[model samples]
Target: MFSDFIELIGAFVLVLAILQISSDRLFFSVKVYALQSFFVALSIFVIGLYSSSNDLYISAFLTLLIKVIIIPFTLFEAIKEMKIKREIETYINITNSLMIISSIIIISFILTRYIDLGGEIISKKIFPISLSIIFVGAFIMVSRKKPITQLIGFLTLENGIMLAATSVTYGMPLIVEIGIFFDVIVGATMATIIIHHINETVDDIDERTVENFEE
Candidate 1:
């Protein structure tokens, strides 16, 4: 029953990842990422409870406090300060993006089938879902023109990595997990600062505009 619940949460995380890619609004994408993070934390907490791992519980708590709360709050505040337009510019059309996402999911399942990770049914099921999330997150980063959207993609990718760790090993050491969380928070803060500077100078948040300036 707990495994089933974890799988459900994993499925929802994948759905939110797809939604983040499909969204045309930056704010909507950020919110979707937050929702995804919340689910990821919940899934981790569940795993910790079932496995009786205190380290995982701490990891889940950090995930909730940082990814679910602090990161999104910081991003939203940055957005408001930048006063950038909400509409996201994308390289690919929605139809093609959705098709690509579907293909990614299918391919992830196919790829994971050949690689056995012990006998745990839950691990086998979640491995592919986590891979799909990572792939979709990378696609989002490449397909979107906005820095904020790309940031969301990066966060999504990190979430996938976290999920994969949980699924494969049950959980990493508490110190290691704390370090990962710290690194992410620092990276996010730096990225937000850079975005703010770019907005101040370029008066736009689009990556294409920044590229043109470099050229």
Candidate 2:
């Protein structure tokens, strides 16, 4: 019962993340993205407890560090420093963004229908949702204009990847998980600094505008 509930909650977070991606305003999207991360962390943490595995604890901590802490802080600093206080000027129109998001959800359900679990209870359940979440994260990154939004999408994708690993295997070796988590933390901090520099040097938040740098 608890596992089912956790899976449901994970699915909900997936929806919320995509909803944030669809939002026209950057601040609201970032806030929603943060909330989504919190939910994802909570769901996974509970699942880890139910399984009584130490690696899931590490994964839980990774979610806390990556999704709850690093991603949100970077996003906040990036937007503040960039002075991007306006609503997001989307790459595609709002209506089209909604359409694409809806399509992603639908396709995810279909794709999840055929996961080859080899008759394992654990495999049968979480893999599909994790894969769908990853796909949605990628879709958001590709659709959004703001560099911060793209980073949110990327972090969310990593969340999905971690979710898949945890759900399918129940846990991995703690040392390996911690090492990978450390890499992500260091990588995100570097990304934040690089993004800040890019914004200052080029005077824009849209990465596509890099092409317009004055000679």
Candidate 3:
């Protein structure tokens, strides 16, 4: 029963990833990413309940506090400050991007069958979906033109890694999780500062604009 709930949360996280990639609006994507993080946090909390692990409970609270609340709030504020909306362009159009993402999901499922990961319950149930989220996140970063969108992609990728860790080993130690949370907060803060600087210099947040400005 608990395992089923965990799998449901994992599935929802992956679906949110797909939803984010399918859309082009930065605000919408940020909202979707928040939803994804909520599910990821829920998964941790549920797993903690199932196993009765205090560390997992603490980790889940931190995930909720950081990923869902703090990060999204910071992003929203940054977007308001930058005064931007949609992504300017993408390397791959929505149609092709969706096709590529579909292929990624199928490939992830296939790969899961061949990999051996002992008897981890989460591994057995939703590892493929977690893997799919990782690849989808990376794809979003590469295909999108704006740095803000790319930042969302990076956060999604981190969520996938977190889900994968939970799947394979029931999550990392509490101290390690705290350290990672600190890194995420710091990395996100730095990225936003750099994005602000880039926007100020180039009058655009497109990565190519920064490169051309450098030239």
Candidate 4:
């Protein structure tokens, strides 16, 4: 019963990831990412309860704290400081993005069907979702021009990796999970600082502007 619920939450997380790809509003994308993180944490907590793993519990707490609360708070503050209210610039239109996301989802399921997950039902259910989330995150980073949006994509990619770890192994060791959390926090902080500097120097966060630096 619990496993089914957690899988349902995982499915919703994938939907949220797809929504992020389809939406152009930067703030909306960040909020969707936060909600996805919250669901992922919930899924982790459920898995810990089912597996009786204290380490998974700790990982879930850390996920809730860092991904759900701290990172989103930092992004929101950065958005406020930058006074950014414009929609994200995307290389493709929304319809095309949606079509691509759909294709990715179909391909993920097809590709996973040939791979073995050792007869773990939950792993079988989540493997495709995690892979699709990762692909969508990469697509978001490639298709969007805003630095903040790309940062969100990177975070989304990390979230997919965490989901995969939990699905495959019921979670990694506490120390390893903590290390990953630390890296994410530091990376997010550094990225936020870089975005601020880019905004100040170029007066824009568009990737094209930053890449065309003369010197």
Where does model 3 exceed 4 Å of error?
A: 85-88, 204-215
Q: What local lDDT does model 4 show for residue 87?
A: 64
lDDT of 3 by residue, 1-215 (tens): 76777788888999899998888777788889898999998888888887899999998999899989999999989888987644546878988999999998998899888777776456475788888999999998888777788889999999999998775578998889899999999999999999888777765444433335545
> Which of candidates 2 and 3 reaches a greater lDDT?
3
Whole-model alpha-carbon lDDT for candidate 1: 0.85
- Residue pairs whose backbone atoms clash in candidate 4: none
The TM-score obtained by model 3 is 0.93
TM agreement with the true structure for every prediction: 0.94, 0.85, 0.93, 0.93
Please report, in order, the local distance difference test score of every candidate based on alpha carbons. Answer: 0.85, 0.71, 0.84, 0.85
Off by over 4 Å in 1: 119-121, 204-208
Q: After superposition, how far is residue 87 of candidate 2 from its true place, in Å?
A: 3.2
- Model 4 accuracy (lDDT, Cα): 0.85
lDDT of 4 at 148: 84
Q: What's the residue-level lDDT of 47 in candidate 2?
A: 69
Local lDDT at 153 for model 4: 90
Candidate with the larger lDDT of 2 and 4: 4
Question: Residue 113 of model 2: what lDDT?
Answer: 82
Model 3, CA-based lDDT:
0.84
Per-candidate clash tally: 0, 0, 0, 0
